[model samples]
Target: MPNPAPVPDHVPPDLVRDFSYFTGPGMCPMRGGDPQGALADLHDGPPVFYAPNNTYDGYGTWVFVRAEDQRRVLQDAETFSSHRRIFEKALGYDLPTIPLEIDPPEHGAYRSLLNPLLSPKRVMAMEAANRARAAELIDGLAAKGHCEVMTDFAFPFAVGVFLEFLGLPQSRREEFLGWADKQFHGTPEERGEAIRTVIAFMEELVALRRREPAEDFMTFVVEARVGGRAMTDKEAVGMGALLFVAGLDTVAAAIGFDFRYLAENADAQDRLRADPGGIVLAVEELLRMFPTVLMTRIAACDTEFDGIAIKAGDRISCPSMVANRDPAEFPDPNRIDLARENNRHVAFAYGPHRCLGSHLARRELVIAMEEWLKRIPAFRITPGTAPLTYGGHVFGIEDLRLDWEVG
Candidate 1:
């Protein structure tokens, strides 16, 4: 039998209407023009509010909209644990997607094994390879005059990096792309199937690597250890699957949205084109304005958090999409100020669980923006096509068409 609605009994009647974190008709609506707009209004109403709209088996959750509050939840994982049993219940399976699913001390060990590949220096060393890939993709579209940036450039460029990182064959793009969609955008059944498919593939790959090792992220995990003992096959598979999902989704969507914004805003495009040197800083500001992931935490004990009563086992969501838009933390939070100062945004999230791949993500975005602007002339959204969007755990721009001058 399905669970009943998770709405709490103590929510103020007036504030009940604003609980818009989950999807469905009466649930919170994602602000139409601005993805974060509904959340901006939400910040005005409550620091932490009960939202009954969670679509994962109708579970209720606490929505955290303030930056400081978000920081508190993410940093203090003891109070707000990272264990994701919600997925277990929703998908009807046990999936331990490492580091991200574990809290503190245990998480550190898993993170350490992968840290070398994502260090700033390592990511910087890959700039030449990353730039070459970006240029290759952008060159193909330069002569065509217009293209769907999301499909043609963003997805391929980002996924290409992921493929190279894992030493996976490029011929498998279509097969893996299908799995990615099912894992993230498909129906619950499709998502469950996708997880099974990925795990199966990883188990096979790990078995192969065990007999004949190679130089890649997967091989690293297969050979790595935790606490002086080798990682079990299950642990390696969990880490690999998480990396596959995280690597393909976030950076690709971010690059797509950043280009979509630039397509509509000529001034911002012109400024970056002229300065060139400012692309690094521009990427930071862009991330601040368009953070896409909403992180989840489960409360560890019955406790009072920021005047709100949170019971043990309740769920809390700290969306970087919401926290980055806090007015008090960011002045003129709605406006995209490329020159914004002291931009301490949680676009990569906050605390111990902050994204391990942030350095690589940043490098990819910066190279992508710089390379695209260099090759493609001034571009704008196709006059009549409606841009398609999806909002949920990971908000995405499904279709983005751009028209540009053909040389």
Candidate 2:
């Protein structure tokens, strides 16, 4: 389902092209369309500008398009805080989503609990399971010779790994994904309902874990401590809710976009298929080109940035979609260079609130790509059918029909 909510009126009609911040029209292009072209135009203008409040609900953010400027905002958490309230304001949600919404000092504490669980070692350990799951999914689709990647493979592959990691029911995969899609791209009412529905389910799951703990992520979280103190049930539920929403959609979107890129660029696909060892480097470049998450911050105090005046409580939108495409940061920003050196893209973000699931996300991407190209012959979008995509808080492919020879 698409976001039926109307684009708020306060968003200047003209800013649509330059405000390539959201997923609607100007930002996310049709499959094989050019989004970076619009973002590049914005970069040619002022580095920082005021986006309208209607773009969000009651408040707007100062859009940052330059990579250097984005780093300045992300690195200086003291000036631009990541406290939960800012996100609540940006997305109109209540109840602080731990780690992501919490600022430094305390933020580090939340990361502590989750760090080892998603560490490179732990993620590496899951490689066999992840690869097994990927191969299973491709096995089901390979015989078809043609399939929609988003629903058929990407969603199931990404969400399956997460459900297994969390010890959630694999049978509820569709129900969980439906809720996640609505939460990100649905109307306000639908988004609110999705949040409530997931949180309610999480609350129940937490209670179940407390009474009869299991060997799962939820059990680990409930048994863990932050700052040497046990997390309250509310905090535990909040973390579960956060993981439910965050874990599923992000990696799924990355897979969707990565495959989308490969579908369009057969040469790149061939190169990866030829050299599996280079898949890791190829994944990094793909993430840089199509980062799905946008990092938003609130001005903690009155501040001046790049000759622009920002006041306390003002929102700052540092969209990786915009920042990663910056010519000053990545040479030939539009082209994908698998061996690009020192690719310090903010795809995983920067500072205290960087993505905790980075290790898992990387592993998932690498496994998905390697397995897909190996099983299926070279593929591309079916002629005359445009692949669908959604924008807003997160941008992703909704429908991608790929066709290949049945070998």
Per-residue CA lDDT of model 2 for 1-33, tens digit only, reads 332333345334444332434543545545555
Pairs that collide in candidate 2 are 23-391, 23-392
The TM-score obtained by model 1 is 0.94
Tell me the alpha-carbon RMSD of every candidate. 2.4, 3.7
Q: What overall lDDT, based on C-alpha atoms, would model 1 receive against the true structure?
A: 0.80
Query: Considering every candidate listed, which one attains the maximal TM-score?
Result: 1
Please, what is the TM-score per model?
Answer: 0.94, 0.91
lDDT of 1 by residue, 249-329 (tens): 789889977988898899989999999888888888889888878888988898888667788888888978778889889
lDDT of 2 at 289: 82
Worst 10 residues of 2 by lDDT: 1-10
* Candidate 1 segments whose C-alpha is farther than 4 A from its true place: 1-4, 8-18, 22-32, 86-93
After superposition, the stretches of candidate 2 with alpha carbons farther than 4 Å from their true spots are 1-20, 23-25, 28-32, 53-58, 84-93
